[model samples]
Target: MSLAIVDAREWQNLLDLRTGKKVKDDDPRVQAPQTATLRDVLRRHPYPGDSDPRSNRWVTDSALDLVAAYEPQLACVVYGHQYFAGRYTPMTDVQRKGMMEELFAEIDRFVARSGYEPVVVGTGDMVPLEGEIDLGKLEGLAISSHWSARYAGLHRATPRDLDHVRSLAKVERVVGRDEWLAAFPDAEAVPARVPEHLLLAEEGWTFVTTGTPMRRPVRVPGRGFRIPLSTRLGAAPSLLDIRGLVLSGAAAGKKVALIVAEGVGMNDFLLPFTPCANQTGWHYYEPGDGFYLTLSTGRHQVFAYPSGYNYLDETDEKKDLPFSGYFLDFPAHALGDDFPGKSVAAGNHSMFVHMVFGADVCMECFARNLYNQGGFGVIHRFR
Candidate 1:
């Protein structure tokens, strides 16, 4: 579910996800209408899917900026756009740094006017609270880092790099890992990398997961009926293992497709097609706390806010940064980079199949300025 929203339309999903029913414009449940849109984040990219946010990156910062500009009598400016980029385009260094400045400026302006806390964060903070999975707390130490690299920087709405995120405030907590591995016993030892802007844990929301970290079985609003995550990751397989399987299958001249059905666990997997194993699952915090990085390269990774797409990831091809690595150098280590056969990546989730996992035919909506609309497409065919 989208944690933050400006217009009433965005709120409908929250209601729909809960009830599994269509919410009408006049539906009392959905109070926000097009007329209620806080700010018109003019779409920049033009494509069939461009209008639908699920298939493209929506200029989310514009909403936050408008709210900050409103300077309401009572309002909090918590900046975080890096989570659940259902679909997106990468950003270049110039684009990322400039927009990041705009994001921080909005927060700074709001704080100066209202004197309220500026909350910025990662996906970890919301995962547990999402109501789908429950994440209990574990122990931990110092802070950690994950952000890395710049891609086509075209179609995604998530921050391409988090380089400027840390500069916005007085540092406190350092980087580490998450709260979910309570079942493992070792997760608590990993440091928690809560960024300065995030304060949900301090507010006592039972500290779920974060763009900051992941853990426990706590719910966001409340648990749903059919959706659930497999905390019982029995013989959990690292995604890297799946990568190997795909390669082997492809080599055998078999048409391979890796379908990642979100929210559905191995226990809940009841698809008609039989998979390699009867029940197979993998946990996210394999090497450390991260997402796409863990998928492309089976190592600890994070995006740049705290990253600017640099720091701890092996994907940063330009090892110019002190912290970045060159694991992508060895195509075999990364998933799609070295696929022996034709690999095509087309998905709503940003930066994954296309950027993180290299693709031959990458199709995504054109991502331009703050917002865009017309009839332009961003499709890359790298044969």
Candidate 2:
């Protein structure tokens, strides 16, 4: 059953309230009216399918109902352009404040009607909730980062290279390997010798860096490239091979599946990672305690917490992080004949799964930025 009714007219009013300007037909916020079910909406505008969430014209009551049905115990509602219009467009400070107020009021109304006391979060104005609330306690679900796979790319960075690149900038993250090498041309070997594991297919050529310290000192530019690196890299690997399976259904047993991926974010709690989780989920935990992913199928519930730490962080007390390895009572199913083909259909998203055999593996994968703005989530429901 559907949970709530979402009318485009209501959305238009919210946008109007936030922007304090009448939305004209030409306005990007203005979308045509075409009512449909949440499933249909998702099917038409699947993650990595539609570039703009607002363009779907189906972010109405049906979408909310779908989410509410999937997670009935949901106690928090994070409203953003995904909820109201779409993200990536520009907005003024006044508009942002107005949008936050509108979202809060709408969430309050939803709570009153549904009897679900959900914490309302404005993507633009996320503040620490002290002792009153813990976002981690709330299921980290969001549609904002459900980006199309077309824009997705796997960034690669080795431990030493990443450190050298990050040292050149004050920001916590860099764009990709090329940008780092581009800014520091000397870092790029004339012959281009890179570790076998780090070699990318697109680059075509590879160069080896020699020396005992493993440090190839190059002439530093007088001024570092001040521009933040592009979060999107052309030569990065593709996540299309990553797959999800329901080894044990939430109904029969706790959901379990074998996940084969290149790396895991230090602050990331959930597997089959999402960009939004990386961007916002980190704030939910303290230094030591990692994040959590709770799964349910109306009859049973299972929780997956981070049991291992892997990633290169300069500020971290421990310098060398371990290679990614995870084992759990609720384990990930191995990819085999039973493995569901190259792609698994989830809601409206068609997640493509790739299998890596033998020794060729990616150990150091880049953590993507919010700019890609596209990601996919899967809820494996087994009978």
Candidate 3:
């Protein structure tokens, strides 16, 4: 069976990331008068159009091309719509719609010639004009969330709200309604919900803990002891900390769901780990030194970062930083004893990483930019 990973991000955000050069006026490169097409601009600044290549737009088109060359059935679904109801930018709804249409058309043509289809999922209201382009005809699922707009407007929508939206869109059959409802419980609600039709189940990973657990310990290689997952109040360091759940499973040929709070940023130690394989959205990091410890035994890799919070507004001050000394206190150790000739890097700070074993044994990770009420990642194996 083929593996699929679906990620949701604002249409403009996706374009900016893929192109590496923001189309905004603030970008000096964007201001340079030229008749070059968007494609040309992207080709020139293949990485984020900045001094730092690992900035927000680190996932270049070439990376996707590489993945496609290996996984023929892979589909990267890009959802177009505002995660929250607000004037996020100076652009009006009409302007936003026009921009989306143009970008979508360019992508459609590119995919037609490339054979690797990146589905463009959008709402009915966001759909292009009748004669412009029929995005629905493409390998994508277009759903109308009009019924759930009321809840979305208040930023209080739940997974159930999204389920209702999918039902209204008439794509429930494509999404397999019964299976979705059965997979995740509607116990806690989140700010935004990506339609189930767009996402495929992540197999193997299982939830071990929900809502931070107290001083429970887990063994770390070479530590010769166990350490708590967390030790802050309520076993969490910040209010943004959603019900922390430990998902344990093999990462063999599977995709893992990631829905992190929008404002959180990774520190310097985490920067190198951004733009993970098959990942989308802004791979941001907080500015400072932090550490992460990792160990790999052939096909199996294990790593952990201290749970911390980084608010967008207060990027300067370090508040509620998860104490990383607990894990980094040990001297740098090589993995030779456990796995001869293997080397493990020592890091300081919170960051997410995905290790690709080989062509057929790659791992997928995704993070969506949305409000942080609560979130969970489930990995389901193919039947």
Sorted on TM-score, best first, the list reads 1, 2, 3
TM value for model 2? 0.28
Lowest-sum lDDT 10-residue window in model 3: 342-351
- Model 1 spans > 4 angstroms off: 1-236, 266-283, 286-289, 298-332, 366-382
**lDDT values, one for every candidate:** 0.29, 0.22, 0.22
RMSD of 2: 20.5
lDDT of each residue in 1-383, candidate 1, tens digit only: 10111122222122232222444656543453321232232132123333243232222233233233332221211122322221133445464345434433443443344343221211221222322211122122112222211100111112322232223232222222232223224222222222322211211122222222332222221111122112111222444344444555555554444433322222323322222221111222211123444444544343212221222334344342111122222123445556655444333332233344554333232222223222211112222
| Worst lDDT 10-window in candidate 2 | 357-366
Q: In candidate 1, residue 53 scores what lDDT?
A: 30
Model 2 C-alpha lDDT per residue in residues 37-113, reported as the tens digit of each score: 22233333323322233312222232244434433222112222222122233456565455434433444444445
Best by lDDT: 1
Each prediction's Cα RMSD?
21.2, 20.5, 21.9
Position 276, candidate 3: lDDT = 20
Can you tell me which runs of candidate 2 are displaced by over 4 Å?
A: 1-60, 63-78, 82-87, 121-163, 172-383
Tens-digit lDDT track for model 3 on 189-213?
1212323333211111111111212
| TM-score quality measure for candidate 3 | 0.24
Model 3 ranges off by over 4 Å:
1-64, 67-71, 79-87, 117-120, 123-383
Clashes of each: 65, 19, 14
